[model samples]
Target: MDHAPALVVCLTTVSDEKQAEALARTLLQERVAACVQVDAPIRSFYCWDGKDCVDRELRLVIKTTRERATALQQTILRCHPYDQPQVVILDCSGADPGYAHWVGENTTED
Candidate 1:
C-alpha cells in the first residue's frame, strides 16, 4: 500500500545456529527488529583479505523500522562473531498495510 509505514529489511549471515539465535534475540530484545527469520546451511562464497573463502552459514532476514534500522545494524556489528559481519539494509516501501503497521508497532524504541 502507498500509505504503508516505513519498514526496513536487513540481511546478515552467521557461522552457526547459536550465533544466529543470539543475534536475532538481541535485535528483538533491543526493539530494533520486529522479526528475524533464520535460514541455515547456506553455502557462501567470498574473498577476505585477498584469500578465496567458501563456508556454510545461516542467513538472517530482519524486519525493522527505518528509525530502528541503525540500532539493529549496530547491534549486529557489536554482537556478531565475525570481525566484519554482513549487514544489508533494504527499504520496505509499499508493503501490505497491516504488516507494515505491525513492524512499526513492534520496533518502537523505549
Candidate 2:
C-alpha cells in the first residue's frame, strides 16, 4: 500500500503526565496533530547545562503529516514549560493506508 508522503510520528518528553495531556489536547484542538498518545513514565538520562541527570518523564507520541510539523512544533514550544523540550520527528513508511489518510485528512494542509 502507498503511504502518505508527509506522514510522520513526532515524539516528545514532558515533565509529567499532566503536562503531556495538556499538550496533547492543545495539538488536537489546533488540528496540528491527528492523534497524541501519552505513555507511562519513562526514565531518561541526559546532560543539561554542565551536569548529567536522570529524570522520570512522560512521553507523547504525536501523529501528523510533515506539512503540519512546523505548526505542531510551534504549538509545543509555546505550551511547553521546559527551557529545552525534546521534539523528535520520525519519518513513517508502509503505514496502513486508511490510517495514513485519516491523519492527513485530520491535520491542516499547511
Candidate 3:
C-alpha cells in the first residue's frame, strides 16, 4: 500500500484561550492548517529576556503538510501576540492514510 507524504504538526503557545481560538480559526480559514487543536491552562516554564518565568498558556497543535509549513509559521507569527511565539514543527509518521490524505487535500492551494 502506498502512504501519503508526511504531515507536519506545529506547536505554539498563547497567553490565553481567546488567542488560541482566533489563531486556530484563521489558520483553518486561510488553508494554512488542515486542523488545529487548542488546549488551555497549560503551565509553561521558560527563560525570556534573561529571566526565568512560569505562566499559564494555551497550546495550539496545528496540522498541515510540509509544503504548507513555512506559510503556516508565517501566518502564526503574524497573528500571534507574542514577541517570540513558540512555533515548533514536528515531523509526523504513522498517521492513518485517509486522515493524512484529507490533510493534504485541505491544505493545498485551490
Candidate 4:
C-alpha cells in the first residue's frame, strides 16, 4: 500500500487557451501547484443560471498538495474569467509515492 500524504489533483476549465495558459502559469509562479497540464478543448454541457448551455472549453489538470489547496483555489478565483469558475479538488492518497513526492517538492517554497 502507498500513501500520498496530502497530494491532490484539481480540475478546472477555461473558455480559451490563453486563459488556460494564464491560470497554469500563475499557479506555478506562486508555487501553489507543481504542474498544470492544459488539456485539449472539451465539449461541456451544463446549466448556468437558468439556461442550458454547451461550450468548448480547455481543461486544466493541477497537481499539488492539500497544504496548498487554499492558495490554489484562491488563485484560481482571482484569475479565472468565468462568473462561476470550476475549481474542483480530489484527494490522491492512492497515487504512486515517488510521483506524489515530486509534486509536493515542487509546490513548496524554497
- Stretches of candidate 4 off by over 4 Å are 1-4
- State the number of backbone clashes in model 2: 0
Ten residues in a row with the worst lDDT in model 4?
1-10
* lDDT winner, 2 or 4: 4
Error of 3 at 54 (Å): 0.7
Q: Judged by lDDT relative to the true structure, which candidate is superior, 2 or 3?
A: 3
**Which candidate gets the maximum lDDT versus the true structure?**
3
Report per-prediction Cα RMSD to one decimal.
1.8, 2.0, 1.4, 2.2
**Candidate 2 on 1-110: residue-level lDDT in tens?**
55564688999999887898889999999999999998989999999999999999999999999888888899988999799999898888887888888898899654
Q: Residue 105's C-alpha lDDT in candidate 3? A: 89
Cα error, candidate 4, residue 83 (Å): 1.3
Summarize candidate 1's per-residue lDDT along 4-102 as a digit string, tens digits: 578889999999999999998988898889999998589999999999999999999999888888889898888899999999999977877899888
Query: Candidates' TM-scores?
Result: 0.93, 0.91, 0.93, 0.91
Candidate 4 per-residue lDDT over residues 1-110, each given as its tens digit: 25655788999999998999888999999999999999988999999988999999999999999999989999999988998999999987677788888888888876
